[model samples]
Target: MRAMVYRGPYKIRVEEKDIPRIEHPNDAIVRVTLAAICGSDLHLYHGLMPDTRVGMSFGHEFIGVVDQVGASVQNVQPGDRVMVPFNIFCGSCWYCARGLYSNCHNVNPNATAVGGIYGYSHTCGGYDGGQAEYVRVPFADVGPALIPDWMSEEDAVLLTDAAPTGYFGAQLGDIAQGDTVVVFGAGPVGLVAAQSSWLMGAGRVIVIDHLEYRLEKARTFANAETYNFTEYDDIVVALKRQTDFLGADVAIDAVGAEADGNLLQHVTSAKLKLQGGSPVALNWAIDSVRKGATISVIGAYGPIFSAVKFGDAMNKGLTLRMNQCPVKRQWPRLFEHVHNGYLKPSELVTHRVPLEHIAEGYHVFSAKLDGCIKPLVVPTAA
Candidate 1:
């Protein structure tokens, strides 16, 4: 098997590796058909996430065919195509029973925060991801679902993480009828969040980003107003002005860890690793929403602390809601949306690179070259 191996910060390569075998009674081995490089994967790629060791693969959004299943795996069988959610969770835990799969207590040893994520880092349970020919899926019965006959391979792959997370971000916002929602960042997640906001009954949607291409995507794909924050002297003030000086009814921060717009914050957090992540986007979200509005944060941040405007949020009585997306929880509605042509998850895909050329794929995506947004990885053997 050939897998993408992380060597160090900003370095990765395709290397031959042994095929993974079932290690637990509930485990299954999947032959990956399609996988996506998520925006959050860049955190691990750039050494922003803690314990992202060398030789580990980085991917969480993937769909594959079941190559083999363990004795206890009953939901799927060999030869079945399945969509694997990013979270590896046991369905019977207290958190899982409550539909909080991302905080499942029975998966990760360090389950104080995030549960289990594929190929995310030691802090996320150290499981290898599916950016390869094969991957080992634990708790297979709970995490994977057969791909719907109507779902495209690209759509199935995005549902594993990026699409679901974006929907989850909108879900956290609790948008009311006629609410004006503002989204930070215009990456895959942000674009999806902006689009989902409309489905959630938001009267208006706005997306902010520094890139022209992504802002344009928000305008075209999401049918939302777009703003290039780089053009404003103070983006928060600009957002307030756009909302008639009262601020937006809701704000979503989809950019995490590597947010720009500040020199000292970016240097101390993203560059020097002094803080968990740059707080620019999150802070902007804090100030851009109305005093009593809601803010949803779906961005990936390091385990360490970062500078955030907690005081202002408390003073303004803002509702702050965020968590890793419980991917499977959003599947039912997302499937319906897709079936009805209400959403097209595949439209977010910008590039598909073979596993052999993943090194180049990572470079292109990390550098944001050629308008790369969501890049898919296909196994060489596929």
Candidate 2:
């Protein structure tokens, strides 16, 4: 088998590796058929995530065909097509029983906050991800679901992470019928959040980004107002003016640790590693929303302190709701949305790279070249 081996920051290559076998009774071996390189994977590529060891594969959003299953695995069989959620968990744990699979207590030694995630670093459980020819899926019954017969492979792969997380962000906003929603990022997740906000009955949606290309994508894809933050002196103030000086009814921070805006914050956090992540986007969300409104955070962040405006949030009585999305929990409804043609997740797929050249794929995405929004990985096994 071949996999994307992480050597260090900005260093990855396709290397031959041992094919993972079923190690637990509930485990299954999946021959990856379709997979995606998520934006969160860039944090690992840039050496931001703690304890991401070399030689580990980095990918979490994937759909595959089952190759083998452990004795206790019953939900899927050999040759069955399945989409594996990013969250790895046991079905019967306290969190899983409560539909909080992302917080399952039985999966990770570092299970204090996030549960086991495929291909994230040791901080989230050192499970290898699916950016390869094959991947080992633990607790197969709980996290792996059969791809609906009519769903496209691209949609199924997106549902594994980007779509669900974006939908979850909107779900957390608790948007009222006539509310205004603003998303601070125009990446796939942010675009999806903006698109999903309309489904929740938002009266207006606005997406913010520094890139003209992404803002353009948001305008066309989400059919929402777009703001290029670089053109404005103070984006938050500009946002307030658009909202009649009160502020948006809800704000979503889809840009996490790697957010750019404040020079010092990006320098200290992303460059120097002095802070967990840059809080520029999260802070913007706090300042750009109405005093008593809600803020939803679906951005990927390190498990450390950030320079967020906690004081302002408390003072304004804002409702701060965020988590590593319980990906599977959003599937049932998401499946219907895709089936009904409300969204075409495949429209977000702007590039496709083979496993042999994934290093180039990472470079193109990280550099934001070629108007790249989302890049899918085509493993040899596919």
Candidate 3:
């Protein structure tokens, strides 16, 4: 099997590796058909996440055919085509019973925070991801769902992470009828968040980013007003002005770790590794929303200290909600939305690269070249 292995910061290559075998009674071995390089993967690629060991594969959004299943894996069979959520969890765990699958206590040894995530990093759980021909799926009965007959492979893959996280961001905002929502970042997650806001009854949606292509996608795909923060003297003030000086009813920070508005913050967090992640987007979210409004943060950040505006949030009575999304929890409604043609997740996919060319794929995506919004990885076996 060929798997994308992380060598060091800014270094990755597809190398031959052993296909993972079932390790537990509930485990399954999946032959990956479609996998995506998520924007969050860039954090790991750039050495932002802690405990990301060399030789580890990095991917969490993937769909595949069940190549083999342990005796206890009754929900799926060897031939089943399935979409696996990013989170690996035991369904009967306390958190899982409450629909908080992302925080399942029984999976990761370091379950003080996030649960097991496929191919994320050791901090989340040192589980190998599906950025290869085959991946080992633990607690297979609880995580892998058969792909719906009507769903496209591209859509199924996105639903594994990006789509659900975006929807979860919107849900965290608790947008009321006729509320104005502003989303920071126009990446796939931000675009999906902006689009999902409309479905949640937001009266208006606005997306912010530095890139013209992504902002353009926000305008067309989410039907939201777009802003290039690079063009503004103070983006928060600009957002306030756009919201008639009161500020937006809700604000979401979808850009994490490598946010690039403040040079000092970016340097300290992203370059020097002093802080967990750059707090520019989060601070902007706090300042751009109304005093009593909500702010949702779905951006991936390191599990360390970050310079945030906690004082201001408390003073303004803002409801700040954030978590690693429970991906499977959002699937029922998301499936309905996709089935009804309300969303075309595949439309966001800009490039598809073979596993052999994945290093180039990473480079293009990291450099933001060729208008790469979302890139998919197709294994040779697929």
TM-score versus the correct structure, for each prediction:
0.99, 0.99, 0.99
List per-candidate RMSD values in Å. 0.8, 0.8, 0.8
On lDDT, who's better, 1 or 2? Answer: 2
Q: At residue 257, what lDDT does model 1 achieve?
A: 89
Model 1 vs. true fold: TM: 0.99
Residue 332 of model 1, lDDT score? 97
The per-residue C-alpha lDDT of model 2 at residue 161 equals 95
- 1-382, model 2: which lDDT tens digit per residue? 9999999999999999999978899999999998999999999999999999999999999999999999998889999999999999898999899999999999899647889999999998999999999999999887899998999999999999999999999999999898999999999999999999999999999999998999999988899999998999999999999999999999999999999999999988888878889999999989889999999999988987888999999998999999989998899999999898877788999999999999999999999999999999999879
The residue pairs in collision within model 1 are: none
Worst ten in a row by lDDT for model 2: 105-114
Error of 1 at 195 (Å): 0.7
- Model 3 residue 124 CA deviation (Å) reads 0.9
Q: How would you encode candidate 1's per-residue C-alpha lDDT over 1-382 as one tens digit per residue?
A: 9999999998999999999988899999999998989888988898888888999988898999999999998889999999999999999999999999999998888647889999999899989999999999999899999998978999999889888889899989999989999999999999889989999999999999999999888889999998898899999999999999999999999998889899899899877888999989999999888999999999988989999989999999999999999999999999999788777889989999999999899889989999998999998877
Per-model lDDT: 0.92, 0.93, 0.93
Worst 10 residues of 3 by lDDT: 106-115
